[model samples]
Target: MRRSGCGSARVRPVLAVAVSVLVAGALVGAGPAGAADPPDRVDNPYAGARVYVNPEWADRAAAEPGGHVVAGQPTAVWLDRIAAIEGTDEAMGLREHLDAAVAQRAELVQLTIYNLPARDCGRRAPQGELSIEEIVRYRAEFIDPIVEILAAPRYASLRIVAFVEPNSLANLVVNTGSRYTATPACEAVLARGTYLYGIGYALARLGAVPGVYPYLDISHHGELGWPDNSGPMTALLLQAATTAGSTVANVHGFVANTANYSVLREEYFRADDVVNGQPVHLSKWVDWNPFVDEVPYARHMRELLAGRGFSPEASVLVDTSRNGWGGPARPTGPATRHDLNQYVDSSRIDRRALVGNWCNQAGSGLGQRPATEPEPGIDAYVWVKPPGGSDGASGQPGLGQPYEPMCDPYYNPPRGSPYPTGALPGAPPFGEWFPAHFRQLLANAWPPL
Candidate 1:
């Protein structure tokens, strides 16, 4: 809910300088309680890093009316700005993005680590074209080139905030051995740990870069939060570290809720909710009373990880782009309807079948803009998932394989009919813009867009 005036010509530079100072302060000496400080003791992660804002964002700021404010302003992109590395994407688009960072002499530029095999569980529209069998080659074709670019000497001074593989690690915990693994594709991914290997290799390689701050993705609270999924998540992190041949020490931090939406603070105030004579908050997993928001979730996970040997210096990052606009006003009583998102219980709001309501959900707003501020074990609140881009298409007739009841416009699962989530019907694919979503997001923006 942090607010700032519109992106005026006079305000942009101030914003940049403020951001630089913020990033510099956090990297140098911020460590969790009782953690040993690193010996290197660099004051600024972005110091001397050759980073710049992308020219496209600037151009849009100049030409696209409101676009100049949202577009040209900094937001991270994957592989290339548009998510694919083909054609001019590698030659021209990437250079443009990097060149802008350099032009502005930005201290940091955000980048996403996508392309894990069997990516997104084949559940969403951008499920990736790679099969589990072809993952080894995926490393060669997709990941390596990006690494080569980041590792290049020309960009040596730039601080790269690498957001590793959104939804990749969480999928390992949620879908691996469950009914979701019904397909051969899911089975292959589970058997091979395709995501773990993919993310591990990327982390080890990218983390080695002097200017890179590698943050592996830990899915949001809904997918793998406290009480329910704690043990499995701890084991997964340890396994991932082992697979990478690097310990948590090599990582700069871990990111949660990359593209998903789960507010960082739950509604419960006192952190005391008794269930069957036991306070739920007292439980190791349910560290936050109302519900486990990203802050407590990240902090608790860090503690759990420390017992297993994760670095205390490793920080947490949360993507606050869309979660700021809480979904429907908190329901007053038990849900009279079947749609899970609206269903509420006494202990918490939105007791849906799934904790995270991803999928181009409706009523979301532009969250806290990207910035580094130390709060509750988190390093920064970033807009890793660009605002206007669509999560997936609403189930319009022709789209293949991935369509589900949640996104289908004509069907509603509760009544044995399917319906799309609010913001989705008009959205495009993964990284493309959706004007409908843009209008809604701008209108619903927390600080009043």
Candidate 2:
């Protein structure tokens, strides 16, 4: 989930030229062999789904011994290069990748666009290279070329499942109050005005790309499960669509739990009200508490959006990449430790601290593989976040960096520290292979490696 850092002052000149060249090349790249007229979208563009296998990820998996289990796993390519100097490189790479897909006659590709200004809400690692004042440049230099590539007739036959800006809107919901959420970056954008408009611009551009299905990122249940946040969250989404100069119909759907580790379900069974030893309802879990997982979250969110004029075709895709808790459940009674791992009820166990925990979490496993089997209002359960890449620093703080809450030597009690443990320390930067996390994931894979 790292936002690639900004360019140093000395490298700005070089980066400027590189970006220009990248955009030029993408707009003029030779059309694919046997390119035909752009494909039309009379029905759902993604209805015929075949997930793309990212060549870069596959190559990495094959070379890393610990990545054997993930070697052939279909992972995604991120557009995190947005606003960074490397954006040009990523754009060029995407054109090349699309060409390769055309050559292979592949049907789908998972592409995540993550470089929004004030990304990660001014979080710990991978602070983006760009600033709020630079968002104009973001759209002009980064998104424009991306749209050109996707709209090109050469790629119209390929379905691009574009996961848009993972944490931008979610951060707005969870961090509106700067002091409480510890997100000064988000506050800065809100105070300056036009933050929502920025989102609108991205969506509008993406909406024009015929073969691209844009799924706006919404934070998971852990952060927005309360009834209080639901209305505001829904309103924020509506604003996003309105400001984008687009309607809900322009978007294919929304994506939840992107790169976050909230499991698909707790060990609850009954579907009627009073299920899970909680209140009785269609969703089976009471809304106010942290009990709502992704399934119920998507169901409720979609219904709310539909009420606001979104197309019924607007759906959801949850990232089931790391929620598989293959380990034994926590003790059903009292916990011997005060950390957040207390057994909340007979059937539910609290795993990570909250939805905000994005680091390499302990005891998490690989979830069900990418699939199109419909689940309630969910369009599909896909692994948008590639497995094996480190979430962030896990070991000792790198080079004079102080210890952070997310990394290893994990704070005691796990909920915000106060206790201690013997767990491994922090990990490498984002996108780099974390051998320890990779092994743990494979070993704990739900169906077993």
Candidate 3:
């Protein structure tokens, strides 16, 4: 793991500089590769060719880029961060953004309902999946809504992934009929379908069976929650693998969280010139949080299995949002105040690398990942969370609140003066970073084929 006593204060200025000229977006052709098809020149967050756009919060794209998430793929809602109430979201313009994405033709709308009482997320040293209440509520709010809508045949052509939560076996086994493309990021042609496969299928591919020494990895961790380390992540992978059956599952484990939890993050961010301007993952940015980084948490299961004489491989998915925070300190989680940030640079101690960690460098364009087969343990490392979006930002100059850091382009008060460098603006609005980074990752990291 990459280790650094660095503080967020020290990072702020660097981030400013990084967000400035260092951060740019332009779509050139993907370099050269041998794995899959040619990659997109720009760094677009929705790594796959299908583009989902919401124009309410930001300006509408004048024209949908060629293969990037264009205007015709499919449009959906942005309800994941829905507020406590339907219309009570602090950022009122969100409704507009959703509408715009829909207007842009996003076939699937994503929603993350964390407001329910069940979502208490009680403080657990290693918090597992959603609390019982959260699961119940998930059914009530999400599954139920989608099932009802699709059941009614309201939109037969309206295809969507019920809940991109880590992975829901029920969702997988219950539903079948899909397209399984070799690479998750298929442009114009990378679209395939498969039927509802189950854990059995995934297990089979990994070369296992029900009674024959169970695969002891995150996949079996019934407790890991929120996708970064446990519950949701393992659950999601199993569901996908099973569902995909012998095929690569599109599991966007929480890169941010996984990176923050692991020591690997440090190595990723330390090498600024590693990938050059090309995206490390073809999408995303970087953030380091030493405390709370979940290393071996997944491997722990492997070790446990090894203790039992199983010594099986580890299976894990990561949620790489807010993870830019890096892993936790020796014993604590991310320092809320940045004073205790124990982040690092982890380049050694190699094992199965699941996904990229903490923040990717991207801008306005479609960035693509080079064609590389998944290592024994990894299925696919994708951009689950749209990049450039602030957890909650207002999307305005000099204003970073709610999560939306700086709006795309990193606009400053002075037209020509760069941001942060020149004292001329307000805090960045919430949810603003999504578009900028989403657009950039696509433009940069796309490998040359």
Candidate 4:
């Protein structure tokens, strides 16, 4: 339910160095250890911890051919709707998942706290069950129940990494503007301050619990990679961090590329490279964004957030669930062509038709396997968005999700330069596991499973 756009590339040099220093601090566990000072808290929640593996998702994955390869790996349990809080006939409730984690001897459990009022304003489908005026109910029903379940003494030993509201704050940054890509729904959300209230309330309540680390979602490089977008987004997030009796301490860090297909790094090209006497950032694909991929984008954003008063211990997490563009089509090296477009097209690993394509992309693969502190400044490489789950429906009947044009492989936008949606066809509604997509992900996994 995220959309994409371009931004200016103007990150200061000092901030870049700050990223390295912060990463060094994280490596040595050096810092005030603000919220992490609690007996149950640690600088990195995933360090020396076994993340929870959802039995429901594991059963689905194991049912597929060759699924055992990844079935044992951990994935986040999403509380996307109210029904999900209390176990549905087909799914486990929040407490059930936590109990299962205890049984599995998992030290860490990842939970995605989605379902803000008027959620996913940038997209037509998968709208939240709450309305704009239902913010009170969102807190009373959604956030309250989750907090109560998590506060149970039996679950206190578990290090809970709660991914707070993916696609919520970032939409307030780019989607509320007057640009052609802007939607009326996002404008209303911005005007009403719905996202800030919902996210702030969730963070305050969740962070109050010991051992709970709240990582706010900041979208990804493809969405907020530019100075114009990133600057505004940093400001908005700061505001959200402090809203509704919440402070910067309420936030542990931020997560990027949640459920979106953006490569972890671009091996062949840099954002400022000049090819054919033209800046790579100016190319159609790069679109002038300073960050060529999620790593730099996330590190730079952490720097910005720290400068804005977040704790120095605040690190970053990347959702490497998808975005590994591997398989036979994966590029080995830089393109020899002098033309800028050709060079970018051939070298980039993200095979989407456009960076804005956020649906069930066709050529994407399982990215880096979930790991602890895989990169400097990254708290963890996580599977926040479970691989093989549908981003949304592609005009499939009997699927409850509405048809979003971006999910239609044949539907091209009228305003922007026309490009394929790159969405795989016959997909089910959002969050349902798709067998074909799972098989493709397995076949193209970067580390070869």
Q: Could you estimate the TM-score for every candidate?
A: 0.75, 0.80, 0.34, 0.90
Candidate 2 off by > 4 Å: 1-35, 42-46, 64-70, 82-92, 269-290, 328-350, 353-355, 395-404, 412-424
Q: Number of clashes in every candidate structure?
A: 19, 18, 151, 0
Model 2, residue 211: what's the lDDT? 72
What TM-score does model 2 achieve against the real structure?
0.80
Model 2 lDDT vs. the true structure?
0.61
lDDT per residue for candidate 2 within 1-449, as digits (tens), equals 33221111222233232222221100112332235555565333334444455555554444455554455555567777643323353233667667756654456667887776766665556555457777887788777878887888778777777787777776776677733653666777766644576677778888887777888877787777676676677887788888857666667888888887777875542223243354322321232353357788777888888887787667688887777756564423443322222223334433554444567777677876665645556667777887767666655545565344555545553334453432345467665666676667777666455
Q: Which digits, one per residue and each the tens of the lDDT, describe model 4 over residues 89-157? A: 667788878877666656678899888998887355665788888999999999999999888877777
Residue 47 miss distance in model 3 (angstroms) = 13
Instruction: Output the lDDT of residue 238, model 4.
Output: 92
Quote the RMSD, in angstroms, for model 1. 7.7
Say which prediction, candidate 1 or candidate 2, comes out ahead on lDDT: 2
Residue 74 lDDT in candidate 1: 54
- When sorted by lDDT, best at the front, the candidate numbers are 4, 2, 1, 3
Candidates 2 and 4 compared: the better one by TM-score is 4
lDDT of 1: 0.56
Each candidate: RMSD = 7.7, 8.0, 17.6, 9.3
Tens-place lDDT digits, model 1, residues 42-111: 4334333323343432332334335434443455656622234432422334445555455455556777
lDDT of 4 at 399: 50
